[model samples]
Target: MAWALGANSNSPPFAPAIGANAISTMRAAFLIGIFAAAGALTQGGAISETVGADLIGGVTITPLAASTGLLVAASFMIFGVYSGYPVPAAFATTGALVGVGLSLGGDPAFGTYQRIGTFWLLVPPMSGGLAYVTATLLRREEVPETVGVPLLAAVVGAILANIRLGVIPHPERAQGSLAEAASFAVGRPLVAGVDVVAILATVVVAAVGFRYIRAKTQVSAEQGIRTFLLILGSVVAFSSGGSQVGLATGPLENLYSVELGLPSIILLGIGALGILAGAWMGAPRLLQATSREYAQLGARRSIAALVPGFIIAQVAIALGIPISFNNIIISGVIGGGLAAGSAGVSRRKIGVTLAFWVITLVMSIAIGFGLYRLLSTVLGIQ
Candidate 1:
């Protein structure tokens, strides 16, 4: 499960970087593997809990059911990896879990389904719109490079300041943002106004950093954009780990206690390893596909696309929502492409990918439900 999810999910964050030639495929994979593992170990718990326990009601997922759901989901994703179609792992995993849960006589958690579905529907448009607007602004001749790039960097920095990190909070409480963690470290109580201060400080620091980079003799405007895009790629990769690890580990949460009796951390570690392996071995093909097929993005357009991808991915993680990085990246790529005109975008490719996403959702559910019944009956375990 982790191998499949990792291969599919880990590629998009760095695809734009690759497209812009800001980073090499191997370097992106290496950075993605390390940061993604960190994210999984630190912040994977909430979404895992949501996937394992909150998606259904009235029954616990037995080891057999969990394994069946994961198998169905992973098989579909593996098929996508080999076939060169980017299937949405979130849709597959969520559908599979719900299917298996229903087969086990669990009640539908319609409210949870509604929340997840709403986000799934909203992310593409939201991400695309933001990227389109950003790209448009960046292309304007009147927008000075010094002011425009730094202002955008400031916004990204502000968002980063507020993102909840898993390693910076009390064990029993939810995570804290960088500012809150800093405040705690300094032995100051977290007041209501502290976030505003943190935001301002982050923006100022980012603005200064961008200004410095721009002033460097070796760093051209294009190079500055590349550097920023690489940073955004890393941020998005870390967020991907936080969001995608749950899809692999969620089903196994119950099984960890019931059968294996392993700690959650250990399960997370296993998932991280699978993700690392997949990122190293299987991610390059999809990375090439996304970077080349979706859009031909330059450094400015790449940054425009990646900023929203980073923000949206982090938002999904904070909300414990399972989202498709493919959806996010493709939307952003299309948005950036649209900034150049419709000619830059490939409608046929988009249609095919969307079709695959819809088909995978339905097929995964059916497979998960049918496979569980067949496996349980054959093994006489249910």
Candidate 2:
């Protein structure tokens, strides 16, 4: 499941960078693998817990149950990955878990489903709207490249300051952000009900990002734009890993935590290795197929597409939501493409893709439930 999940999913978020020639395919794959592993190790904990425990109520997932559900989900995802169409891996995994939980007599987790479903519904318009605004800003005559590019960089930096990571000490599942850690290290001084140190840290990071992008632009506008795209893609890839590894590792969370008496980090590490291997072995081909053939975006449009994916991925990670990065990136691509006139975008393909997401979710649920029940009956385990 981890291997197929890695191969099928994480690569597309960075397709823009490779498609734009901002980075070599081999190098980008290498960096993506590394960053993805880093992200999984550092931030996969909360998401893993959410999936393994919170998604279904009253059922402690047995190893057999986990294996059954994952087998069903992974088989479907592998078919979609090879068919060269974007499949919603998150939907499959989430639905599979729900189905298997039901087979085990667990009650429906409507609250969790509601939260995830709402987020999934919002991805299209929110990502498209943001991408359109960013692309428009990049194309504006009044906003110089130096100012506009740096402004976006500053915004990313500000967001980066508040992203939670596993390395930060926390009371429970809630990890601390960089800004919070900095404030704690110095002395939590409140300025008008705000952490003074966190505010200062945010400002400093944002200013530094702004200045750095501006300086890069000063050196060479074209190179600077490419450089920013590469950076943005890398961030999106990292965020993708954090948001995605959970789908593969979530089932194993209960297996490790209960029976094996192992840490969740160990499961994350296992999934991370699978992601790294997938990125190294299979990412380049998928990257080429999606980027070169599907959408040939230039540097400006690529950046616009990536920025929203990065932000949305981070938001998903922070909220412990399992997200399909392809869904986010495709919406951004459509928005960015439309900004330059919709000549390159295909309405039919988009419609088909949306329909596939819903179908995958419903079908996975049915498959998981039936498969688990059948296996339990034949094996006399349940």
Candidate 3:
């Protein structure tokens, strides 16, 4: 599961940077591995809880069921990665889980499904629309480079400031944002105004950073933009790790109840290793597919696409939602492609990709259900 997810999820975050030549494929893989592992260790709990514990009711995911579901989902993802079409790992995992759950006589958690479904429906349009607007504004001659770039940077910084990190005070219980951590340190109560303050502070810091980068004679504006793109990609990679790790580890959470049960941290560590391996070994092909096949994006458009991808990813993580990084990045790419004109985009490819997304979900569910029943009845296990 980890290997499959690592391959699928780790590539998109760094694909833009690789595509823009801001970073090499190997370096991107290394950074992705590091940041993703950090994210998994620190912030992978919430979504893991949701996937393992909240998706189905009246049944605990048995070891056999968990392994079977993960194996099926991973196999599908592996096939996609090698075939140069990135499958939605979340859909595959969710479908497989639901399939296995139903086989075990578990009822659907409709409320949870509603929430997940809503996010799945919203991500493409929302991220794509936001990217379109941002890309359009950045391309406008009226919007000066000095004004536009810093504004976008400020928005990113504000999001960063408010994003919850797992290494805060109550690491075992709840997460904490940078603002909340600062507030606690200074002996200030976490009032409603703290968010506003954090945003303002982050904006100032971003503006200063942008100004410094722009002022450097050694660094051209294009170089500065590339640097920013790399940063955005890295941040998004980290967020991907946090969000994607849960999908792999959630089913394994059931193992904790057995006699030789591993701890949550250990499971997370194992998942992190899988993600790292996937990033190193399997991410390059899909990265190329997304970065080149989907759209031709320059540094500016790449940055625009990644900004929304990062934001949407963080939002999903915060809500304990499992999302496809491929969907997010591709939507952003399409949005960026539209800014240049539809001539740069491939309509047929997009159509096929969308169809596969729907097919994978339904197929995984059916396969999982059938496979579980076959295994149980044939082996007389469970």
Candidate 4:
């Protein structure tokens, strides 16, 4: 599953950078693997919890259930790889889990479903709208390239200050953010549930980020732009690892952590390795695909696409939501492409991809339910 995911995800974040000739293909793939591993280790826990524990109720997930669910989900994703449509990994896994849970007589987790479903629905429009607006801003003649580009860097820096991570000083040793550490040092000042110190810290970081990007731009506009694209691609690639690893490791979360009395970090580490291997072994071909397909869009639109991808990815991680990077990236691509007018975008391709997403979700549910029931009966394990 991780291998399939790596192949499926290879195109979105780094491809545009490759398309823009910002970095070599092999180097981008190498960095993607390493950063993805880092993200999985640091930020994969919340999503693992959501997938393994919160999606189903009234029954514990047995080893058999885990195997069954993962089998169904992984099979669907591998099929997607050969078929050439990027399957929604989160949706496939979530549906398969739901199916196996039902087969085990677990009740539906309606609240989790509601929250996840709502977010899933909003992804297309929200990502699209943000990318559209961002692309438009970058193209505006009134806004200088230095100011506009640096402003984006500053926003990302502000967000980075608040991105939750599996780190020190978090309650239960689970998670905390850079902003939280800043607030901790300042006697825990808070106003309207916002950390005053954190805000100041984010402001300082944003200023630094803006200044650095601006300086880079002033030296050589084109090179600075390409360099920033490389950096942005790396950031989004890291976010993809954080967001995507859960789909592969989610089913094993309970089996490895609770049944074996092991730590969740160990489970996340296992998933991280799978992702690393997958990225290294399988990412080049798809990266080449995008090198051809995405080059025509140019750098600014690609930047617009990736900025929303980074923002939405972090938001999903903070909320403990299982997300498909494909959905967010494609939506952003479409939105960003539209900024250049209709010629750059494809309507039929969008329609086909959208249909496939729905089909993947529904089919995974049915297959998972049937497969689990058959496997359980045959093995007498449940």
On lDDT, the candidate that comes out on top is 2
Error of 3 at 132 (Å): 0.6
Residue-by-residue lDDT tens digits, candidate 2, 1-382:
7777667788877788887888887887788788887888888877788888888898898888899888988887777777777777889899899999999899999999999999999998889889888998899999999899989999989988889988897554458888888988876799889788998999999998899989999999888888888888777888888888898899888779888999888999999999898788767766775676556678898889989988998988888899888789888888887888877777777787889989999999999999999999999996
**What are the per-residue Cα lDDT tens digits for candidate 1 across 1-382?**
8888678887888988898888988888888887777778777887898899988899999989999999889988888888888889899999999999988889999999999999999988998999999999999999876667767776777777777766678444767777656655656544674645555556666666566545631357776777778878887888888889999999889889567788788888898898888888888888888888888988788878888988888878878888888899889988988898988787999999999999988888888888888998899996
For model 3, the superposed segments whose C-alpha errors exceed 4 Å read: 171-173, 190-219, 257-262
Per-candidate TM-score against the hidden true structure: 0.94, 0.96, 0.94, 0.94
Candidate 3, residues 234-308, lDDT tens digits: the string is 888888989999999998887863535666888888888999898888887888888878887877788878999
The C-alpha stretches of model 2 lying farther than 4 A from their native spots are 171-174
Least accurate stretch of 10 residues (summed lDDT) in model 2? 287-296
Candidate number that wins on TM-score, 2 or 3: 2
Who wins the TM-score comparison?
2
Q: So what's the TM-score on candidate 1? A: 0.94
The backbone clash count of each candidate, in order, is: 0, 0, 0, 0
- Per-prediction CA RMSD (Å): 2.1, 1.4, 2.2, 1.9
Could you tell me the lDDT of residue 308 within candidate 3?
92
What lDDT does the true structure give each of the candidates?
A: 0.83, 0.85, 0.83, 0.83
TM for candidate 2 is 0.96
Error of 2 at 164 (Å): 0.5
**Pairs of colliding residues, candidate 2:** none
lDDT (10s digit) by residue, model 4, range 1-382: 7777676663468876777678888888888898888888888888888898999999988889988898888887777666666778898999999999999999999999999999999999998889889999999999988989999999988988888777646654567788878888778788988878988989998898899889989998787778778878888988899888888888888788877989988888888888888788777776765544432567888788889999999999989999888788888888888988968776777788899999989998899899999999999888
What is the lDDT for 57 in model 3? 92
